[model samples]
Target: MFWHRATDYILSSNYMAHRFCYLLQPGLIWTNVVMDSLIAASYLLIFLALFWMSSRLRQVAEINRYVWIFVAFGTFIVACGMTHVMEVITLWWPIYRFSTVVKTICAAASVPTAILFVRIAPALTRNMERFIFMLSTTQQEKDRALTSLIASEKLAVAGRISASIAHEISNPLESVGNVLHLLRTGAGLSPEMQRLVDSAQGEIIRAGDIARSTLSLYRESAAPVEVSLVPLLQSIIDLQAPALVRNNIQIQTRMRATVAIRAYPGELRQVLINLIQNAAAAIGEDGKIFVRVQPRRGGYSITVADNGPGVQPADRTRLFSLFFTTKGEQGTGLGLWLAHSLIEKLGGRIKFRSRTAGEAAIRGTLFNIWLPLGTPPYVPLAPFSSVQAGRRQMQKTASVASR
Candidate 1:
């Protein structure tokens, strides 16, 4: 029985081979060889592309949402390429059955690859939208950083100009102060003349102080010393009084505590001066500015409030940013930034609240400063008395002039 079956199988194979032998004719054989070679070359290119894409997918698999889908598609392409290879093999050898099996496997892979592509279409669209949003946000941040850098450069240039101006003004100011002193001491013609001289002297002295302060701002402090807050605040107010009066801005003060804090007095004074000046600038005629100082746990709080055109909501967030100003060309936009830096360096915090007109019950800005209290390492008390005396002299002269 085994011999009969073997002979039957050989006879059947030989009959089929002879039936297809006409395909081996020279012209047909050459055409078949060329077509098969072209198909093989096309399949080779497809296989290479799938291999490269798969390697790339593997590299970014963690971030890629449809990695599995891409991998399945690559597998389908590889299988399809293999079926083409099998087709090429069957042209040279009678492996038609093997070629049919390869095509069946390729068809199976293709179905799931198509299904996965359909399933991941929505995800790919969503990921594309997210990528676009992130790219836009990154571009915005880069633009903002570039703007800040330009502003910083401008600020540096301004500082250099201020230093040069201060130096030039200081010498002539000193000479004028000396001549004013001599004129005041030389016998006065009348009380009115004396009062005028005194007022002019006072203004000149204030201008000199401003120049000195401007120069000092660019330099480091000599040392941290105990500074009396009440006197410092009073002197700043006195210095700004002329401007406040000219603007018809009423001043009110409530000094609940006269605490001392270890700090750079010059810098602290600069902060207060900037705050007060800002308040005065915000207000119109008949505006009121209220300043208060109170003791807090381990520190003191200073509040400066004004009934002025309050800060706009949009400008609030960038209030302390360098060169961000609402004052247009009149402001250099350095006051608040410098104040913030000084306060932080002195181990203090400064905060402000503002409400625009018609937006709140009270329409104005309020600034609060908190400084840690500390005792002085050495008694540097002479300057306080002199400042107080000068303030008193100014008050007396103003009273006389008013009369």
Candidate 2:
């Protein structure tokens, strides 16, 4: 507003002085030349400023910006025409009526021009805020993508060594199971003894199940499928029913949008399953796990936030890193990593924030995944190059020979 007022005052004063000078002495060629030169220079400067403002307005993609630009340009053109007319009336015609008409038109154009500029002030401020938010979100997405890439690399290594790990642990587990079974079957003559033997057998069976579950990690594979996101999430909640009940973790959601995204259905399921399990585990016996699904800024945002012991700042960077676990012996340290990798492959982003005020209150972790609206590419194909196959073959043989 100050700038608009200043510009209006300067232009109006110059126009009045130039008009008076030309009308009083139209016969003096040198006097008119000097005044016209000054006036033309001033006009050039104003046009330059207007051009700069218009260029800035074009940078913004919003409708408000476009409207403002159009209004400003129209006002500038009207003002320029009025200024030209005033110059012609004072220097050549010496007509009082024409000068007054030009002045009136200039004044009228200045009014809307000033109002339009003021109107966009609030929009400019709002646009700044939106820009900041988008920048933050983009940075967060970048960090999550990096984490996923690291996790994928770790998983690839894990996959390569998985066979050896399974074989090493399997033999001992089998031996232990056999030994436990034999011990349970050993003869005892009392009813109390038989009951104890039956309990021991049950314990052995549970141990075997646990071992098998752990060993099956190497066999995991993901195949792409088109899955309705809503039903899929609901099914995961159902699967974790026992764990959720045991830990008193509540599941709440809404997915009425019903957008089916292309993904490795099993992998996506496993990701949610791991996250849900972690949420419940963190809460222990009496905390809520909030799961929400809704549309956000042209995309879908799914969040699983829990009231539990939040992650420490030191642990944030490595949260999705392989073998990074805080669960002591109860965790494999690969769950979060696997989840992050799978989500990224499905063209979604995963992020979380751990918030805690102080030591006295319960801390909480909020994990959010933003899935871009529309179909995600399923088949990841390598770029074709003439020498790609030859290069790959050479590298393979070189590695083998080195080994």
Candidate 3:
């Protein structure tokens, strides 16, 4: 009896479901099959796209709070795809119960997706705004850095060209100086003409000194040798005479003793020139510069003092820093730095004293240099006698020219 009733109930349920099904004509069945297949394929493509988006979002999930919303969207797309897949399956099999389950899952996924979109919309908008601001700031910084790079490249090129020109000028300057020396010694002239020739010679010598200094900028490191301090300082002063005369600056020298020290001559000359030039630039017209050399314990102390608008205390600290200049655009700011480095290499020290214009009691700058009379690497074959002979020869030439 029980088996017969179960069979009857099954038959009734099947008949009712069949009544709901449309007539399965050949064309209609094929059309439904094709449409369902296409829908499934489209849903698969949508699922793939959503999956890719979700993976990208996952990469930044740690930093982004909106990751969960995107994840929910992907879940909703997957559920939708499953419903289409169920539709394809139901077209062949009567899996109506499974199709209903897939529909329920899709509905569940869509609810959270909608709620999350509503909750996270403002946050996403704020993130977009911040991203735009950061991009703009980054672009501005890149532009500024590019500009600075271009400027630096231009300055470097200019420096190279200047160095090359200075080097080329050095050779010609030496040749001209030699020619002037010959004219001064070989020519016979009246007193006035002789005086003019001497003046020209002096000017030529000064030009030669400038050329040498410029060349030294490009030259390699030179070996230290014994050099007389008195003559070296005098030569620098003579080289600076034209500038001094133009500014009406008077130079006073007091030599307590003549001393020789082991040093790099070019570097020493460069330092002296830089100091004196700085003094000349500092002083006004009719200013006085006092240079004093005195024997110390086992070395010599040379002081270069100038009456000028002195350096402020704040500026003294950075005086030896490269490219840090008090004279804007006009100064290279390398003189004091180079001098300090060269002085240190020669086992010497440099110091300074100054009082600005605000200090009415005293207002000037003084640079003190101390160099030890270290053991000479090698004795010069000819000593002070060679210098004396050169002076005698010059006097004789002048007298002969006068006669």
Candidate 4:
């Protein structure tokens, strides 16, 4: 009873008027002020650093996905900082009641921070392990993974924008075609003029085909379709002709698969287009690209071959790995990776062979994509044994040279 009364008396308003006396306690007073002030400042800086980190995380979609968790932890940090501020303020003012309240808030905030940390600890550990494993890989592997992650996001948005671009290109191209038509059908024309007009008309039609098919390149349909390889491959050829001509390269395309295949046209277009573009880049100058579509047992074989300086033997192993580019800064190294991924996803496979420069009389590269007999349009195929097991089987059973 005596101790309780004494505690109440010490905390009472009448006995709490010690601000001046406390200040007079020279060494202790300054020590408390300086140490508490520094601590408060440190907490404030920590809070600012966390805020800046959150802002940066917002710019990267993959990293920003878990932003709210960090934000909650930041709130706990700020709450702790507020308690330190209250410590500095209460030294002179002696507002123990308010100071106690700030401490209570800090404790409350820490609870959620602790819970969140526990909840995410396993995920954090797994990611850290993955990161360490990635670090152990060759720099090229790391670069490919990081660049592909960033590029994947950009490509998602670009798909929509490309559809609009294809529309706009078609509109102006049609207008120009009308003017050319008027010029062609006009009365008096020399033989040279007649030939030139006919060529221009053919070029305009090719451009129109390119624009229409380009819509398929980006505006992919959810369901597969009966896609004719002839028009599809021809459109791809027409699309790339301008670039090939600029490099003094000739592209020869043959279509022996007269029947249509059950497939997603956009995916096939993207894969074929990437192959052709890669072929163009491979054969830098004065070369030939032969694209052939032939019937295979269950599906069709689409092959893109070039007579350029073939890929180095050292690079052949990592050719389909994401971001493995022979073009250096000019390549995203994503083409073959996407091609391989899409082929697998479509129940198909890709194989390639290359003879480096001077390795043969005609050094070149050939990429062959073999597809399975696909399901009907809008039909879903059976899943492999398991996602992980399927992937493991693919890695173990498949080979770059496997038929």
True-vs-predicted CA distance for residue 57, candidate 1, Å: 10
Worst 10 residues of 3 by lDDT: 11-20
Where's the lowest-lDDT run of ten residues in candidate 4?
379-388
By TM-score: ranked, best first: 1, 4, 3, 2
Stretches of candidate 1 exceeding 4 Å from the true structure: 1-77, 80-149, 183-199, 312-324, 328-342, 374-403
* lDDT for predicted candidate 2 compared with the true structure: 0.68
Name every residue pair that clashes in candidate 4: none
Local accuracy of candidate 4 as per-residue lDDT tens digits, 137-244: 768787767887786767655655666677779988899899889988898988899899899989889878877876666665556778888888887787888999
Query: In terms of lDDT, which candidate is stronger, 2 or 3?
Result: 3
Instruction: Estimate the TM-score of every prediction.
Output: 0.61, 0.41, 0.48, 0.53
- Give every collision pair in model 3: none
lDDT of 1: 0.76
- Model 1, residue 374: distance off in Å is 6.7
- How do the residues 279-346 of candidate 3 rate in per-residue lDDT, one tens digit apiece? 88889588999999999989999899999999988898999865678877879776787688668767
- Clashes per model (N, Cα, C within 3 A): 0, 0, 0, 0
Please report, in order, the local distance difference test score of every candidate based on alpha carbons. Answer: 0.76, 0.68, 0.74, 0.78
Candidate 2 Cα errors over 4 Å, as ranges: 1-224, 357-362, 377-403
How much is 126 displaced in model 3, in angstroms? Answer: 42
Candidate 2 residue-wise lDDT at 86:
59
- TM-score, cand. 3 vs. native: 0.48
lDDT of 1 by residue, 176-279 (tens): 98988988899845888888888988888889987877765443344677778888788788778888899899999988765577887766777888899889
